[model samples]
Target chain A: MPAITFIHPDGKSDRVETSDGESAMQAATRHGLDGILAECGGNAMCATCHVYVDASWLARLPAMADDEDALLDGAAAERQPASRLSCQIVITPDLDGLVLKMPERQV
Target chain B: MSVSGSPVTGGPSAIPHLDVDPFAMNFFADPYPTHEVLREAGPVVYLDKWNVYGVARYAEVHAVLNDPATFCSSRGVGLSDFKKEKPWRPPSLILEADPPAHTRTRAVLSKVLSPTVMKQVRDRFTAAAEERVDLLLEKRSFDAIADLAEAYPLSIFPDALGLKPEGREHLIPYASVVFNAFGPPNQLRQEAIERSAPHQAYVAEQCQRQNLAPGGFGACIHARVDEGEITATEAPLLVRSLLSAGLDTTVDGIGAAVYCLARFPDQWQRLRGDLSLARNAFEEAVRFESPVQTFFRTTTRDVELSGATIGEGEKVLMFLAAANRDPRRWDKPDSYDITRRTSGHVGFGSGIHMCVGQLVARLEGEVMLTALAKRVARIEITGEPKRRFNNTLRGLDSLPVTITPA
Candidate 1:
C-alpha cells in the first residue's frame, strides 16, 4: 500500500493509505476527504477533481491527456502548471508519497 | 443562404442529407435505428426535414458539449434558436445562458446543491425509500413505473423543496412539456404544452417567496436575492429552473433502473450480493437507456468538427442516447452490465451545463436501489412494459413487475 497526502488550500493535510490500481479521486472519495468534488465520479470529463501535484513529485506522474488538458482550462480554480485531474492519476507503489493540493472550488 | 463545400470533398451536394424528422411520432417510438443511420451517415448529417445538422457519434457529441464557446448553449439547447425564434417559454436562466451569466447562476446552484447539503437529506431519503419498498413488497406485484419509480421520488423530492403537497401530481406533466419543448413545435410539443398549462401555472405561483416554505431550496434562492447575489425578479426563475428540471428525469432514471434489473436478473442477483453496487447499477441503467435523448447546440462560429465544417448559427443536434451506445466508445455498448465503469457516458450530459440536479438524482437512485436490493430476491417482468413517447425523454408508461422477497 502507498500513502497519499491531500493538502487543502487552507494549510490542512489529510494522509490516507491507498492501493495500487484505484484512482487518487477514488482514494479521497473512499476516505471522505474534503475539497475533492469528483462530481462526474472519476469520469475525466468534469474538472471537479482538479488538483495541483507537489512540484517535488510532478515529474514522477504520467502526462496529462488531451481531454484532461481541455477540461482543466474550464476548472473553477486557477490552473497552475502542476494542475491535473485527480481522476486521471492511477496509484502505483512507486508513487508512495504522492502529494496533491486541492483546488478551492470545482464548479 | 446555401452552404458551400462538402465534408466528403466531392461537392456541396455530396454532404450526407437525411429526410428524418427526429421529432416525428414514428421516429420517437424507436430511435435506435434512426440513431445508427445518423451516426453511420457522417459526422455531420444535414436533417433536411428539420433543416438542421445532427451528430450521433460519441467523440463528436462529447467534443461539442465540451467546447461550449464554439458550439454554444446560449441561443437555446432546443431546436428553436432563441435569437431567431420565439422560445416556448422564457429561456432557462441556467441552461440557456452562456458564460458570465451561466457562470454566476451555476455558482449559486453549485453552492445550494453542494455535497454537504445533499448529505443532509440522504438519511431521510433512505428511510423513505425503505418504507416505500416495504409497502410495495407487501403487494409482491405492481407497476414499477407508477408505483415504485414515480411514487418514490414524488414521496421525497417535493417535500425536500417544501412544495405544497396538494398538486404535486402536476409535476410530471409540467416536466414532460419542458423537455418536449426542446424539439420542434410538433404535435407532441403542442399537446404537452396544452396539457401542462395548469401545472405550469401552479409551478409559477409556487416560485414566489411567500409560496415557498422557509429553509427549503426555493427559499434559499430567494435569500440570495437579499444577499444581492441575484435580483429579486431573478430568484423565482432560478427556483423555476429547479422545479422544472428536477423530478421527472429522476423518475425516468429510476424506471430505467428497474427495467434493467428485471431484464437482467443476473445483474440484480449481483446487486443483491453487494448493495454498494447500487450507484453503479443506476449509472449503468442511465447509460443503457438514456432518459433525455437529444439536445441541439448552435455553432458560434464556422467550426470544423471531425472533418465536417458547421457554419455559424446552424443548429447541431447532439444525440446523447446514440452517443452512449456508440461502438466507438464502449465495448458491448448495447449490453446492460452493472459492473461496467460508465464514467464518461453522456447520459446526464457533460461540461458546464451538465445536469445540475444529478447529485440529487444519484442519491435518489442509490437509496431506492439499495432498499430494493435488501428486501427483494428476484425481480421479473409480469407484462409488456408500455413505452411513453416524448420528443426528448425515453421512459415507460407502465412496467408491471413481481418481486420475490429475499
Candidate 2:
C-alpha cells in the first residue's frame, strides 16, 4: 500500500494508506478526511473534491481531463497553478507519497 | 432487532419486515415519522407493503449508489422492475441505464449539461429569475409554488431546451406523469396519466430533433447523434429524459427552499445578510427536505448489505430523503441551516447516475433565492402550505406568502 499526505488549511497533515487503482479522493473520504467532499462520488460533476497538488508532484500527476479542467473553473475557491480535482488523481505505486493541499473551502 | 414472520429457508436472507406504504398520501404529507421508523428498523429492512428491501441509513445508501454494478438502475428506477414489467414509457438512456449503455448516453448528456454549458446560460437564467421575482414581489402576496417555483422554470427551461412557446405549458403535466409513473400503479399515477395525455403527446413531438430550435440542449444532443457518439434512436429518448427530469425536479427544489426559508426565518435572514449563501442555502433545503425522496434499485446479484442478505433481482428502495436527514450522518439534521456544508448530501443522489443536470438545477435555485434575498426582507406565510403529492417527488403545490421589501 502506498501512503498519501493531505495538508489541510490549518497546517495539519494526515498521511493515509492507499490501495492501488483507488483515487486520492477515495482514500481521503475512506479515512474520514473531511476536506474532500466528493459530492458527485468522484464523477467530476460537483468539483467539491478539489485540491492543489504539491508543486513537487505536479509534474508527475496525470494530465487533467477536459471536463475536469472545465469544472475546475467553477470550484468554490480560487483556482491556482497546480489546482486539480482530487478525484482525478489515481493512486499507483509510482506515486508512493503523493501530496495534496486541501483548499480553504469546497461548497 | 426483531425478525418478522419466520426465517426464510430459501435464497433471500430474513430481514425485519414492515408494512409501511411509502406511497400513501398521508405518509407522503409527513414522512419524517415513517423515516424514523425505517431508519430505526435496521440498515436494510423489507417493506412488505411494497414487497421490496429498503436501505434507510446513509452509509448503506451511499455505498449502494456508488456501486451501481450490484444495485443496478437499468431495471427501472421505480418500484416496478423493468425485467418483470414493461416500463410505462421508453426507459431513460441515462437514468434507467447501467454502464456501457449508460456510459455512452451519459457522456453525451454530461457534455451537454456540463458546468461549462451551465455557466454559458447563467446570465440569462439569472436575468430571468430577477425579472420573474421582481414582478411577483409587486403583488406582495402570491402562491410561492405556482408563482415563482413553477413559473421561473417554465419560463427559462423551455427556452434553454429550445421548445416553441405555444405548447410549453404542458411540460409540467408531462413531467408529473413521467415522475409519477416511477412508482406503483396507484390512483395518483392513474389520475396523472389520465390528465397527461395531451401533454405527453406534445412533449413526445417536441423531443424530436426537428421540433426543437437549433443551438439548444435538444439540438446539441441530436448533434451528438450525428457525430456517431450516440445512436439516432437514443437521441430523442435522451432529450425526453431531460424533459422528464429537468423541470419538475427543479420546481420542487426551489419550492422546498422557499418553504424552508419562509418557515425558518433565521435561515432566510442568514441568506439575506450574505447573499453568497444562496447556493449553500438551496443545497441545505435540498438536504433538509429532499424533493426527490426515494429511488428503487434492482439487485444485479445476491449481495450482503449491513449484514442482511438480499437475493438477486430483489428491489431495494434507497431512502434518499431518509438518508439526507439521518442523525448518524448529519448533526442537527432536522434544522435548516444555510451555513453548513451540504454538497455531500444525497438530495441529488450520488455516484455516476447522480442528478446529471444538478448544476442546472442549482443555477435555477441559486439565482431565484439570491434574487429574492436581495429584494425581500421577510417572508411570511399568509395561508397554509399545501403539499403537492407525487409518487416520487415531495414539494409544495401552494404556499401563500407575503413578502416585505428589503
Candidate 3:
C-alpha cells in the first residue's frame, strides 16, 4: 500500500494509505475527504478532482493525458504546472509518499 | 444547410449519412441497433433528417464534450439552436450560458450544492431509503419503477427542496417536458409539452422566494441574490433550473440501477456481499443504461473532427448512451459489470455543463441501493419491463420484480 498525503486548500493535512492501483481520487473518496470532489466519480471528464502535486513528486507521476490536460485548463482553480486530475494518478508502490495539495474549490 | 450559411471546410464530401430520426418513437423504444449503425458508419455521420452531424463513437463523443468552446452548449444543448429560434422557455443560465457567465453562475450553484451541503442530507436520505425499502419488502413484489425508483425520489427530493407537498406529482411530467424539449419539436416533445403545461406553471410559481421553504435549495438561491451574487430575478429561474432538471433524471437513474441489478444477479450478489459497492454500482448502472441518451451541441466555428468539417452553428448530436457502450472504450462495453471501472462514461454530460445535481443523484442511488442490498436476497423480474419512451431519457415505465429476503 502507498501512503498519500492530501493537504486541503485551508492547509489541513490528512494522510491515508491507499491500495495499489486505486486512484488518488478513489483513496480520498473512500475515506470521505472533503476537498477532492470526484464529481464525475474519478472520470477525467469533470476535472473536479484537481490537485497540485508536490513539485518534488511531479516527475515520478505519469504524463498528463491530452483530455486530462484540456480539462485541467477549465478547472475552477488556477492551473499550475503541477496541476493534475487526481483521478488520472493511479496509486503504485514506488510513489508511497505522494503529496497532493487540494485546489481552493472543485466545481 | 448550415444555420450560419458558412461553407463546410475540408473533410470528406460523401460522408456516411443516416436517415432515421434518432428521437422518433421506434428509435427511442430500441436505439441499440441504430446506435451500432451510427458507430459503425464512421466517426462522424451526417443526419439527413435534422441536417446535423452525429457522433456515436466514444472517442469523438468524448472529444466533443471536452471541447465545449468548439462544440458550444450556450446556444442550447438541443436540436433547436437558440440563436436561430426562440427557446420554449427561458434558457438555463448554467446549462445554456458560456464561460465567464457560466463560470460565475456555476460557482454560485456549486457552492450551494457543495459536498459540505450535500452531507447535510445524506443521513436523512439514507434513513428515508431504509424506511421505503422496509415497507416494500413486506409486499414481496412490486413494480420497481413506480413502487421504488419513482417512489423513493418523490418522497425525499421535493421535501428536501422545501417544496409544498400538494402538487409534487407535477415534477416528473415537468421534467419530461424539459428534457424532451431538448430534442426536435416532434410528437414526443409536443405531447410532453401539452401534458406538462400545468405542472410547468406550478413549478414556475413555486420558484419564487416567497414560495420556497426557509432552509431549502430554492431559498438558498434566493439568499445568494441578497448577497448580490445574482440578481433577484435570476434566483427563481435558478430554482426553476433545479426543479426542471433534478427529479426525473434521478428517477430514471434509480430505475436503471434496479433494472441492471435484476438482470445481472451475480452483480446483485456482489452488492449484497459488500454493501459498500452501492455507489460504484450506481455509477456502473449509469454507464450501462444512460438515462439521458443524446444532446446536441452546435459548432462555434468551422471545426474539423473525425475527418469531417462541421460549419459554424451546425448542430452535432452527441449520443452519450452510445458513447458509454462504445466497444472502442471498454473491453466489454455492453455488459453490465459492477466491477468495471466506469469512470469516463458520459452518462452525465461532461465538461462545464455536466449535471450540477449529480452529487444529489449519486446520494439517492447510494442510499436506495444500499437499503435494498441489505435486505433483498435476490431481485427477480416477474414480468417484461415496459420501456418508457421519451425524446432523450432511457428508463422503464414499470419493472415488475419480486424480491427474496436476505
Candidate 4:
C-alpha cells in the first residue's frame, strides 16, 4: 500500500493509503477528503481533480498524456509547472509517499 | 485496442437467460426491480427477448464503455447492427463513429463545448436561471417539468446552439425521436418517428450554416470548417450532432434534479443551506434518476466478463441506469443523497464517446439549482408526478410541486 499526502490550499496536510493501481484522486475521494471533484471519473476528461505535485517527485512521474494536458488547460484553478490531474496519477510502490497540493476550487 | 491476443475460449459456468423485454413500457416505468435482478443474475445475462446480451453490473458496464476498441460504437450504439441494417437517418459522425473519425469530430466539439466556452456564457446562464426561478417562486405551485425543466433549457440552450427562434419548439421531439430510434423497432419508436416529421425537418433546416447565428456553438463548429479542419459537408453534421445530442438530455437531467429534491426533502434542505452544493446536487439527481437509461454497444470481438462471454458481432445492451444503482459500487445505492460523490456514475456514459456537451449540462444544472436554493425553502409535491415514457430515457412528464419560499 502507498500512502499519499494531500496539502490543501490552506496548508493543512491530510494523508491516506491506497492499494497499488488506484489513483490519488480515488484515494482522496475514498477517504472522503475534500478538494477533488473528479466529475469525469479517472478518464482524464475533467480537470476537477487538479493537484500540484511536489517538485522532488516530478522526475519520477511519467510524461502527462495529451488528453490530461488538454484538460488541465481548462482547470478551474491556475495551471502550474507541477500541475497534474490527480486521477491520472496511478498509485505504485515508487510513488508511495506522494505529496500533493489541492487547488482552492475544482468547479 | 482491437483483440489480437489468443482467442477467448470458455464461456461462463452458468448464464441466466432473462425473459425480460427491456424496451417494454412497464420496464421503463419501474426499472429498479428488474435492474436489481439483472445485476444479481450475472455480469452478462442473455436477453432472449431481443436475442441480445445484457450487462447490468457496474464493473462490466463501466469496463465496456471504456474499452471502445472491444465494445465498439461504430457498429451503432443500438440493437440493430449498422453492418447489416440500413439506418433511417445518417449515423452521427460523433456519436456512432470509431477513432480517427470520432477523434477528429470529438476534437472540434471538445474545444467548442469545454468549460472555457462556459466561462463566456456563465453569467448569461446564471441570469436566465435567476429570472426563471423568480417567476416560479411567485407561482408557488406549477408543473416543474414544463415550467422549469423544459422551459429553462428551451429558453437558454437553443440560443447557445444558434438555433432560430421560430422552430425551437421542435428540438425536444426531434431529440426524443433520435433517442427512441436507438431502441428495438417497436410501436413507440414508430409513433415517435411518425409524429416527429416536422421536428425532423426543423432540425435539418437548423443544421445548415446559413440558419445559424454567429458566435454560438453551431456557427463555432462551422468556424472549424473555415479553418479547414473539417469539410463544409461535415460541419452541418457536427452541428446536427450538437443539436441531436444536447437538448433533451438536459431537460431530463434538470427534471430529474427537481423531482429528486421534491421527493427527498432532506437533501433539498441541505442544498438550501448551502448553495455551493448546486453542481453536486444536480449530479446526484442525475445518478439517482439515471435518465439516459441504456445504450447498446456491439462487441468487436469476443469479450469475457466475471463468468460470461459474449461473441463478436453481438449486441451488448448496457443498462447504465442499473449500473448507477448497482449495490456493488455504490453505498446504499438506491438512496438519493446530494453530498455523495458521484464521479464514477455512468450518467453521461463514459470514454471518448462520453457526452461531449456535459460541461454545458452541468452549468445549466448548477445555476438552476443554485437559484432555487437561494430563494426556495421547500419543494412540496402537490399532485401525482407523471412519467414521460420512452424506450431509452427515464424522466418526468409532469411534476406538480409547490415551493415554500426561503
- Candidate 2 local lDDT, B165-241, one digit each (tens): 88887888888898888787899988987787798789889999999999899999999988999888888999998
lDDT of 4 by residue, B310-400 (tens): 7899999999999999999999998999989899999999888888988999999999999999999899999999999888988999999
| Best-performing candidate as measured by TM-score | 4
Q: Which residue runs does candidate 4 get wrong by more than 4 Å? A: B1-12
In terms of docking quality, model 1 is: incorrect
Candidate fnat values, all: 0.08, 0.36, 0.11, 0.42
Runs off by more than 4 Å, candidate 1: A1-107, B1-9, B12-14
Winner on TM-score between 2 and 3 is 2
Report how large a share of the reference interface contacts model 4 reproduces: 0.42
lDDT of each: 0.86, 0.89, 0.86, 0.88
Better of 1 and 4 by lDDT: 4
Candidate 3: segments with Cα more than 4 A from true spot: A1-107, B1-13
How many pairs of residues collide in each model? 0, 0, 0, 0
- Across B1-406, the per-residue lDDT of candidate 3 in tens digits comes to 1112122445555467667688887787778888888888888888888898999999999899889899988899988899999888889888888888887787677666655566688889999999999999899999999999999998889988889977887889899899989988888888877777698789999999999999888888889988998999888888888898889999999999999999999999999989867887998899999999998999999999977878898999999999998999878888998767666678997777788887788889988999999999999999999998888899999999999998
C-alpha-based local distance difference test score of model 2: 0.89
Model 3: what TM-score for its first chain? 0.97
The ten-residue window of minimal lDDT in model 1 chain B covers: B1-10
Model 3: how far residue B326 lies from native, Å: 0.7
Task: Determine the TM-score of chain B of model 2.
Answer: 0.96
Candidate 4's docking class is medium
Most DockQ-accurate candidate: 4
Q: How high is each candidate's TM-score? A: 0.83, 0.90, 0.82, 0.95
